[model samples]
Target: MIVMNRFARRAAYFLIIATTMGAVLCTRVLTSVHAQATAPTTDKAVAIMDPTLISRGEYLAKLGDCAGCHTAPKQGAPFAGGLAMGSPFGTIYSTNITPDRQTGIGHYSYAEFERALRDGVAPGGKRLYPAMPYASFTKISDADMLALYAYFMHGVLPVSNRPPETMLPFPFSQRWGLFFWDTAFVRHERFKQDDKRDAQWNRGAYLVQSLGHCGACHTPRGAGFEERGYDESSRLYLTGGANDNWFAPNLTGDLGSGLGRLSPHDIAAFLKSGHGAAVHIVTFGSMVQVVEDSAQYFTDDDLNAIAHYLKSLPAREPSGAYNPQSQKAQEMAVSLKTGDVEHPGAGLYLAFCAKCHQTDGRGVLQKFPALAGNPTVLALDTTSLLRLVIEGGASPQTLNGPPTRKMPAFANQFTDAEIASVLTFVRTSWGNEARPVAKRDVAVLRGKLKK
Candidate 1:
């Protein structure tokens, strides 16, 4: 009976493998047929190389923030990719995009380049991981695509540096499976202008949806790891997404955690300088890199357009509304000032955070971010807040921004319960009605960070 059972289990495992291989083969055939049917009849000829075209391409590259992911931290050459991008499956290192025939994309023809960028399919039919953000790049206009090609092929210096190839384990290692994923999720369509909106609005939409690929980070993902929405037509677009231990806050015009309180100018200023004087909020997490590598160099008009589009998004998760006049807020303020340590974490706040954040929960303008009514403070997910407290953070040093400020990590100074208590107090007080943080939440995050 034991021998029979062992044989049965082996048979079942083989059957499962056979089924998966059959499915993959079937999908590969379908994908091949689809490609043949939809392949372009003629390649769009590469634009004539000129200084004007190269300059324009350079500007577009900045808009895409290509270097932010392609270049490794501290020592990487521009676009000689070796950045380690974290994902659910495993670590995916970026490929070298420099124009080196041996190690980079130097051999790619214009058509091949377009296919890789727009369809996530490289030369000789190699399928790229969605980490490349091709879903958003697919919406890039033909003219702009040619400009980018010109810039990459001619303007950028070639480097023979080859980054390590991505090798996800098991079923994930099967690249053909991505064909079905793309067929089901990716929209192979270009941006269509909204006739009802003005040119500026349409331009903003194009930049945000296409080259900027903002949705790649801001929009939430589905079970299959596809972005929930691509455009403003869907409420999920820019409603917040958590990735790699950080939460990218909602960009919609929600009264609480989104940008409803901020104007277009404020948004533009924040993008350019990492701090908006009008709102007293500074950039944190991955957004600091975005400002440093991409947004800070944007032309005034384009910055305003991107800001305009973001502000136009309708509110989705509008729960945390600030009311300074509320009894709870006034009580907390008075308690802190009068040395009343009644609140769960008020005493700790006075000891560590009060100097920077102030007793009233309003931080120093342009230096420390105000906790009251701040979007990060009111965000539903407390992951970023927890991480910030445990492992400190610093303001980005932009060319025109004020001097950078650093927050000391409290992981060594405070226990998990203490950190949770202080964060919970900040969220609940100062008209910020966000949810409370638990000790376990901090403990779980701390353990992950250690790993």
Candidate 2:
């Protein structure tokens, strides 16, 4: 009996070991695959310095949005690097991008930076994660590339904040796996001018398709993070994208349904200030950072060129903006409760909003947009619109066309239910016709608040 027991115990120990080994193997395999799926191709990051070269690098850095991603929040140093970005996969830490000899890019040569920016390859040929967006930067002109190199080498102060590693699932931790992902998805291409188009259009194309990485946010992603469409070839290009849980609106020429309301100058103005009367609506969510940081810094001519280029793109029909006059909506309109004047939503609106947006639901002219007729009230997905209603409002994107004052958040005064009711009432009232919002959505958004 003792001999038999000893054999059984040994068998059980071996089983545990096998299980653990299998798990480790699976993790490694999966991580490699995940990394490859999103790793940037052709890493070329290097450390080198020349006075003239550094000046050129500065321009490239601005166009590339280097500081926005690499700079730590509220730090006196510029490119010290420690920004934390949240993605569907996990949190990605921006590395030390400064000229610090011991801890930053000081060790890298010009070729290394170029490779990192264009090829997505790090030193020793390790792959960079796709968050760097070198896939887009590869389209930059050689002159612009020199400018960018100059900027990083001299203009920016370097700190010693090495960004943290990403916290992806086990299978995604392997750096080598990023190779496969790049192989399948990444394509190294140069921006070729259309023989028929003018200089402005070509410049806009390069900006949109390359340095700006506009598609990173505006274009939808296919399986494995391959952009659904890289250029105008795909109908899905720049029509919209899902970003940080918010849907970026379509930029196509769908005048009423998409960016049709924006004129070229208006688009330029909006990109400059985040508000304009052409659209007269403000956006929240991740785009707030884009305008506040990168887009606002663009030159007038560049902004105008972008607007003209976008205006020239074809408008595809987006199915989201359903007509509200269907039989179902008409019935719901009749179903609204009439005797709720003293209800929480109505009370809040009367107490706080009546001065500017009258009790009848009409707001002042260009000074204040009428919520009754606003398309924002009529969007099928009310997430952004609801946010605006409860958060007070955002400043108009236009600098000159409209007033720039923004609505403030009201998290302190009204409860979630009250906020929902006010938003629902606006959707159903004064000729607007979108779905009503729920209190739970408000509660969920509330959970995302910093305080």
TM-score of each: 0.91, 0.74
Candidate 1: tens digits of C-alpha lDDT, residues 89-177: 67899998999999889998777888899889888888899999999999999878878887898889999898998997656677766
Per-residue lDDT of 1-451 in model 2, one digit per residue for the tens?
A: 6535644554454344444455455564565345434421233223224556666566556656777788778763677777888765557888788878777887766667767887687766777888888778877776676567656666677677666666665344555556555545566667889888888988888888898888887777764555777778788888776655566667777643466656787677667776554544454566655676577777777887888888888876442333345674454334433433643365566667656666555565445555554444555456666566555555545433345556667777768888888887666654555577899988876765431
Question: By TM-score, who's the top model here?
Answer: 1
CA deviation > 4 Å runs, candidate 2: 1-56, 317-381, 387-406, 410-420, 427-451
Clashing pairs in 1: none
Give the alpha-carbon lDDT of every model.
Answer: 0.86, 0.65
lDDT, candidate 1, residue 357? 89
Ten contiguous residues minimizing lDDT sum, candidate 2 = 39-48
